[model samples]
Target: MRPSLTPVPLGVEPMTRSILFEGLFVHGLPRNEAFEAELRQAGFDRGDLLPQYPLRLFRQCMDIACRHFYPGLPVEEGRRKLGHHFVQGFTRTVLGGAVAVGMPLIGPVRFLKKFPEHLRFDTSPILVQAVEVGERSFRMEFRTGVGLSPHFLRGMLEEGLRMTRVNPTLRVVRHSPISFDLHITW
Candidate 1:
């Protein structure tokens, strides 16, 4: 019998925290007072979120914000929006500059091919498996081990492709409680 998997709390890298806050600010959300309240309700505080802390609190805070910001919004839609916002926010960082430098040379296909190496799994639970299906197409599967919602993964993948200068089409080929697969074609 398969052992019961204990859900692990994942860490949010500094870059991710920066992206999330920037995304919230871009959306015109009150990132200070309101966000603090949300964090408190989610069992965390500003102190707890320093740089590289477990993301459970942040995820919980986002969930609360999603409900408040977009009342009656579908979870999937919220995740997608969050994903897009994350990329926008990420683009303003130092790492974004490095990625931009490679845009002209690497292009989206090669970037996606090497995307998995970008994730810092030592601090986070997110894992990615990329399978190249064609010259400019691929299937990327994210395994979060129940730490994150699949819809969020879908959105991140979609926007990441777009940032790579590709007008890619993304389809959710599969989804489950712990993982999801996205088929991307440029």
Candidate 2:
């Protein structure tokens, strides 16, 4: 059966919307009338920052944007590419500067452990945990109540590690309806 497209009332922070549009722009997605229409259909206003938009709205807009930019692209690949763009765009923000200063000293594993402190998940139900498994390896697990795509998370983690100048190897050790595990090594 096709998944329902009913909007879920998840209050995402304004930065999340900013980062998403910035990422789409960086990837050359047209921010034209059709894009605005998608956003509207997803229940967002074009002129206002979506500080409390539904999670489904974000997901629908992202999916539409991806398809518009790259017709016939695989969903997973589109998600990965979008995620990569997200990290690149996000790192230019003020928070990224703070993250950069500590990445070299704390490393990706520990950096991830502290990542949750930066998020404002007042409406979403996503939780992240990082556990060290070896000297240079860690397992980062995400327990998501919302149906976030794993490929997107993988790309974000991969790019995050790369930003730290760490050549990372990532593997999906587990995936279920509610949780996913990523084994990361540098």
TM-score of every prediction relative to native:
0.73, 0.74
Q: Which stretches of candidate 2 lie over 4 Å from their true place?
A: 1-33, 45-47, 97-102
* Top candidate (lDDT): 2
Estimate the lDDT of model 1: 0.64
For candidate 2, write residues 70-137 as lDDT tens digits.
56789877877677767776666576656656667876766767765554344566777777888888
lDDT of each: 0.64, 0.65
lDDT of 1 by residue, 30-134 (tens): 456775676666665544434533456557666876776655788778866776666666666566656656665777877787878775534455677788998
| Total backbone collisions, model 2 | 0
The TM-score, computed over Cα atoms with residue i paired to residue i, of candidate 1 is 0.73
